[model samples]
Target: MTMREIAFSLVAVAGLLATATAKAQAPEPFGRPGASDAKGAIELIDPKVLRVCADPNNLPFSNRAGEGFENKLAQFLAGKLGKDLAYVYYPGATGFIRNTLNAHLCDVVMGMPQGDDVVQPTNPYYRTSYAIVTRAGADLDGLKTLADPRLAQKGRHIGLVANTPPGNVLARLGLLAAVKPYPLVVDTRVDAPGADMIHDLEAGAIDVAILWGPIAGYHVKRSNGRLVETLLTQEPGARMSFRIGMGVRHSDQEWKRELNRLIAQNQREIDRMLADYGVPLIDEAGAPIAVEP
Candidate 1:
């Protein structure tokens, strides 16, 4: 669940893991012999510190520069726990959880889908959707769905990540020719598809793009009011929104409980933080959340 970035797509993560250098020359997985890992023993909890496993270069999520929202969330939680914050850095490309959290290098991973089967997930802290991005004043600015027939018109180049939910919708609509595909797996160390998609949209290389909400939000905010991102909540067929939470080992029930409590107690603050980053939050009814989360 490098995302659920918080990649709502298991396909994307698997693609990255399959393509990255995780398979060859990768060491045998290592962690404390008696620790909670494949053996499922009790995890070693350092009550004095919060160690997080994060991609060193992913932004609007986490990065070594401490600018991503997950970095800020980690800092906030560590303060709430009265613990020092620490990080175990790696590219999120492949074998990330296996090398870090599963190896006992870190205790938590922010931005996972709530019910993902890999790591035990915490209570959802926020919910977001994939979104459509376009130039602020452009004709596609108010676009709400891939089913929009306007999309089939000539000259509407779409920059979409391959194999995503919206991609499916587009395919069903027979608008494949409109798409200028973006890759599912790239070196997050130096390449960001979301940013690149937004850049292309801005530079008119592509007239439209569909991307994860958080990624779209962050870049759009930095675009000097030149872009707009509309939530895909109204789309049909493909599920576009999901709840996001943190991840820990299954054996860490107490840890999960504590995190759940923190989430419950400070959800409003968390909402504000995500909103500041421009994340497109949704509610249970699949509507855009009110300004107040």
Candidate 2:
């Protein structure tokens, strides 16, 4: 063969080898369903869909129309990732994490409290304080906060949902005598009617109620301005606010890291969402006492 022909053959072989190498190094498509990559903002596979588990009837958190604060956050995440939002609804009851997210039925939980709970939380998106909800037109003028000594006075029954951190906190503070325990009826579907407790409150069966911020806020709003007076409490340890965050499966470290980044970048928007839902702005300690109007 001529020298030129030999040289040409060698060049062609080298070009073919380079092409093959480049193709091999390219990233494989994302394995999970509904993953995406939006212009390199985050490394996601195409056709991304964020499968979020949420409650269908719970308000100020999530609902069927995706109107809740967490629902909006999920939508925002989907938009940030350039993916579609898919929801799996289950009442936010007990065993939700284990039965749903842990079971791999959904990829994320919208509002898991940050702590050593069933699932791990990403960075907190919003903070809220426990508020004291009372019957409409009731006098909270002297209450000031949960630490008010008047709460321990006779005839003032504090209604608390059963088996929650607040209930436990109340017990630790030596306030259990003043508390009227209402079996937790949400999420667990324990055959107890939450409305019964509320009814009892309306009938003057209970003078006060201590519930989580979201639930309290929701009840106050739904009362149509009738259930008046919410006092921000300063009960010891009650001052410690629970940080609600998104939860991912324990094995999803990569996904969790990505979610934390997204939360950090959009903290302001998240705060606004919580507020728009009537979730009171809380301090680091989670008490709703001194939030600016």
Candidate 3:
């Protein structure tokens, strides 16, 4: 069988395994500090210091020193609520939500992607699109989006992060035959596919790359505009525009309501924060979009 067939089979098996696991597990509490218990009465958390969970070193998104976008957003929320701010730093990979927020180590998670399996979201604060990055002066300039027909031509290679929306979309479209899949998180070695993609883009080895908006934008700015970024069109079953919101315990309805209010009240400031982090704001139609307070 082909690689795609193998991948499909693995996915089917994984789904069955996940369903079996869920069936074997017992039902548990879903909400956070101020949420209702089994009896359905609301429990409230005393609003004091807003405990935010975030990554310690991920740039353009979050970090420990209040330098990233989420950190700034948390500070903004604290200022609005007249509360102190504290953070619990951890790596933002697979178990971030469950280990941090669900475990009650932190009261909130800044910049959690909407629709994530764990934690509950407040009002969505911003929307971002995935992008295709290429070398400066590459022929990709005429390609406005991922659906551009020119990509099907031979002799062109695109790099994608494995298991992400972009990768899955490409695979479904039969573009994976000409694309190189990379692991952005797992293979941290210097010669890994992700690092190689970056190096090759600078070296003009590949014609294009698919990466998340914030990551691509950050690299473009860091590269002094040596790379060109084009926002991709939304594909069916692809998470093109992701809504980022603050995550609270599922039981924290009071806090969630308060956060939603804060998000609505400060939409403009939040937009500015995301822009500061180089996240491209785009609308459902794939046009340039901005957030306003």
For residues 10-129, what per-residue lDDT tens digits would candidate 2 score against the true structure? Answer: 111101000000111111223444444554323222236788877665555566887767788889889997789887776554445555565556778776545533455688776654
lDDT tens digits by residue: candidate 3, 1-293: 33222222111111100000011111128544554452222433335667887666555555556776777878888899887888777654445555666666677767655554355678778766667888777778756666677788888788776655666677677788888766544311122333356777788667897766766766777788688887775676565655556666777777788889888988888877777656788765767776453
**Model 2: number of backbone collisions:** 9
Give the top-scoring candidate (lDDT).
Answer: 1
Question: Candidate 3: global Cα-lDDT?
Answer: 0.61
- Name the weakest run of 10 consecutive residues (lDDT summed) in model 1: 15-24
- What residue runs in model 1 are displaced by over 4 Å at the alpha carbon? 1-42
Task: Single out the weakest 10-residue window by summed lDDT for candidate 2.
Answer: 14-23
Off by over 4 Å in 2: 1-47, 168-178, 185-203, 228-233, 237-240, 285-293
Best by TM-score: 1
> How many times do residue backbones clash in model 3?
9
Q: Which candidate, 1 or 3, would have the higher TM-score against the true structure? A: 1
TM for every model, in the order presented, reads 0.87, 0.71, 0.78
* lDDT scores in order: 0.72, 0.56, 0.61
Candidate 1: tens digits of C-alpha lDDT, residues 21-80 = 132123323334444342223454455678898877777787788987888999999999
Q: For candidate 2, list the clashing residue pairs, or say none.
A: 34-48, 34-49, 35-48, 36-44, 36-45, 93-187, 136-228, 146-233, 241-285
